[model samples]
Target: MSPISILTFVASLLFADLVNADRVLGAYIFQRHGDRSAKAWPPTKLTSLGYSQEYRTGSFFHDRYISDNSSYQIDGISTDIVNLAQVTASAPQDDVIDNSGEGFLQGLYPPVGSIATETLRNGSTIQSPLNGYQLIPMSDVRSGSGSEDNTWLQSASSCSKAKFSSNNYFNSKSYHDLLSTTRGLYQSLEPLVNQTFSPSELSYKNAYTIWDLLHVALIHNSTASFPSSVTLTDTVMQELFVLGNEHEFNLAYNISDPIRAVAGMNLAGEVLTALNETITSGGKSKLNIQFGAYASFLSYFGLSGLSSANANFTGIPGYASSMAWELVTNDEGTGMPPHVGH
Candidate 1:
């Protein structure tokens, strides 16, 4: 897993760098959106809990990358009012992802209050709204804008080769076998979605969709009774989770066809490019963050050989899960002679 690097479970990576490098120059972060209403059902939104989760996750990173207490803090980065040029952020136009990005940034650059006040020529001091709230701008990578393709966050419809590979999974023998074996399992859960999805959608083909709806409802609508009287046992939920994981993982990566993980490949390139900026700018550009989904995580894990290093890496990432690439070196001053780390 050594071609390039970004950190998910960061302890190992950070520890390795601490042993090899003296100063952290910069970093590139790619994080999943916070919990939301299930994507399996549309009109999805970022829940309040989702917002909190993202904020906490961002604050955690702030402690790790920008706070004075952090030993690995990115050199030359701001801890108060943001130097916007030193950092860059982006997310898709999607509501869930975009809002999650805002929440995370709020944590990363918290209200500086009087610390950010500016004195006018008349000697009157003014503070930004919400107690010197940092107005950090994030680029909205609009869908179908062609930017997504380059950034490795593109929708399925945009990548013909990847799309073709994903569709091929549906026609495979393994798919057919699973559909047959899971017939009764899926049929039993029909009562839960019969009112919303038509009868045709109650089959194994919609395993992930059906499971997603139920899973999200359990988390967000726990006070309410389920639509059906059947016992929604934990065993059944786990089974459903496994099935959905299998389905989505297949869609994201297939070792035989590199095209399947195009998004992940592009993500590696994007991360490399971001880190390169820090090197070229002599550490002036210190941090870069992007909000995204787990499909890209799965794709990247498989493509970058992380799955081989740790089997758990193949699984879909959870809400707010982040991977980072730190640009670090032993050199002093502002000269950023970057060193790569796994």
Candidate 2:
């Protein structure tokens, strides 16, 4: 080959290598919440024991990340995405266990006549403590009663309309039918959920769990006295504990193409920006960003509702504000070039 040609070839090779170097401009992450007890409802709320379970779940995340290891760290200039908005139309109402009606109460006490006999049988009681205990006789307890006639009127009233309708609104069949419809809706969206991430992805199991947690937290922040800083701290803590393990480390290491990695990061940043915008906007809906389910971008970010919301958002089409960069050949290498024309 001629000297000039040889020189040109070497120069092109070097340029290609330079172009291939990864430059991460942004990133977007959508994650599901960590594991949680079933949704608060007749069937799902934590039993008296469930309260402990909830605390333990919270403690696990807290200790794993917040106290034990400060693991969530990233390189380069980028943006973080989080949804601070309240997306749930309603809060989780009193669980059904708390509202089993008069029958539940009746079961706790002995039969109306039996209670008096038991109180007398115990004997040692100085005077059977009746001040706090308001037990109605079994005969007096209302039977064949509708919901309103139930013993725990106050408890029943605390339940939300959604819960009441599902449980007490109609008989068990009506409740089951409503439940079926809800399940059907969820099943229809199953494809989108499955597509959001791959099984091999880091924290895949925790992704959906985290999403649900965030949803719960968002609701708490909206209706209760939860501090935003506490919620944010909880979020960061979970990310560090859950996503900063060896699995993700290896996955990050496996990417041989620097430009693709950088592109992925940039895409992640865009998502973060959108999420931040959604939170700051004070709207009821969450920011939904959908990449193919296999992408795992949301899991990477440690937020959840984005993908779920993406699947359901009626106003915006899929992947709003998404920027596509072209894999182009430059003097450097296979690099993503900023596309000028759409």
Candidate 3:
């Protein structure tokens, strides 16, 4: 999809049904960064379209929680007025991830009115140059060995156990089965892969890279840079894409080791933390919290049973897509908590 269209797709598919519960005390949003150039390319950053997409996501939240008549508004906050002190956002210390949060915050709390128009005692007028643009803060969580908060936000690479499982999965019986099943299709795609990357050999192990290239080209490139020989139909591309996605899901989360669940839990742990804090504080916790993470984590989260009760957690969330979790008290008056992931 083009950058513009992906924004609309994300809005309808991801954030449309986030607030269908009773007394949505607060919400936590985990979003994948918006579209960008292929990682293989140097200086991979958010494109103009990506900025627009992320900004739209931020704006969507602003309207839902910051606008007048918002059902999910935070306490001690006014409509059409944002309390920057009450908001919290975090992402791994990567430019793309950082910029994603920044763009979203800009749209969520854009400056609407002048800061000040003051006249000094000496008849000198001092005016602020903010130009009605509000500057909100976003936290940068450390990845790797630096901090624990980013373990899930950067899970795919940070989790050593998941990494070990990934390597083993590549050589497991299941991997062999998948390879045999898609052998024919892989053969057909061999030339395309080679033409694109010209790697030493295009095997099942590295097929996802080829798919990534094709996926990026399909969305970002037109007939200009895309090769004429690379003539895979939409059906063919979809099959390959699904195959790769399934492979990634299995590799990232479904290994035989129990540690495979670490990536999912690390991120979900934050959600649970927020929920618990909110519940403990009499539901007066921060209403909106956003964290950016990789897409593979989304898949792992889907299979982690956190969203199993949720029907909308059927597939992987798309680019700039987000999953919201609502914490609500049960109607039984027994004081049991029901944490709903949507």
Best by lDDT: 1
Candidate 1: where are CA atoms >4 Å away? 1-18, 142-157, 332-342
Q: Candidate 1 vs candidate 3: which has greater TM-score?
A: 1
The window of 10 residues in a row where model 2 has the poorest summed lDDT is 1-10
Give the Cα lDDT of each candidate: 0.75, 0.27, 0.57
| Model 1 lDDT, full chain set | 0.75
The best candidate in terms of TM-score? 1
Give the higher-TM-score candidate: 2 or 3. Answer: 3
Per-residue lDDT tens digits of candidate 2, residues 164-234?
33223224353345334434333332332344333332233233233333444443435344433333354
State the RMSD for candidate 3.
6.6
Ranking by lDDT: 1, 3, 2
Looking at candidate 3, the ten consecutive residues that score lowest on lDDT are 2-11
TM-score for all predictions?
Answer: 0.88, 0.18, 0.76
lDDT of 1 by residue, 201-310 (tens): 77667776677778888897763466546888888888887787677777788889889887788778878788777767766788999887777788888887888887
Residue range 253-339, candidate 3, lDDT tens digits: 652464655656666677777766665655456555555544435444555653355433333355677666654332322222343
C-alpha lDDT of candidate 2 relative to the true structure: 0.27
Q: Which stretches of candidate 3 lie over 4 Å from their true place?
A: 1-22, 115-130, 142-156, 190-196, 280-284, 299-303, 306-315, 328-342
CA RMSD per model (angstroms): 4.8, 26.6, 6.6
For model 3 the TM-score comes to 0.76
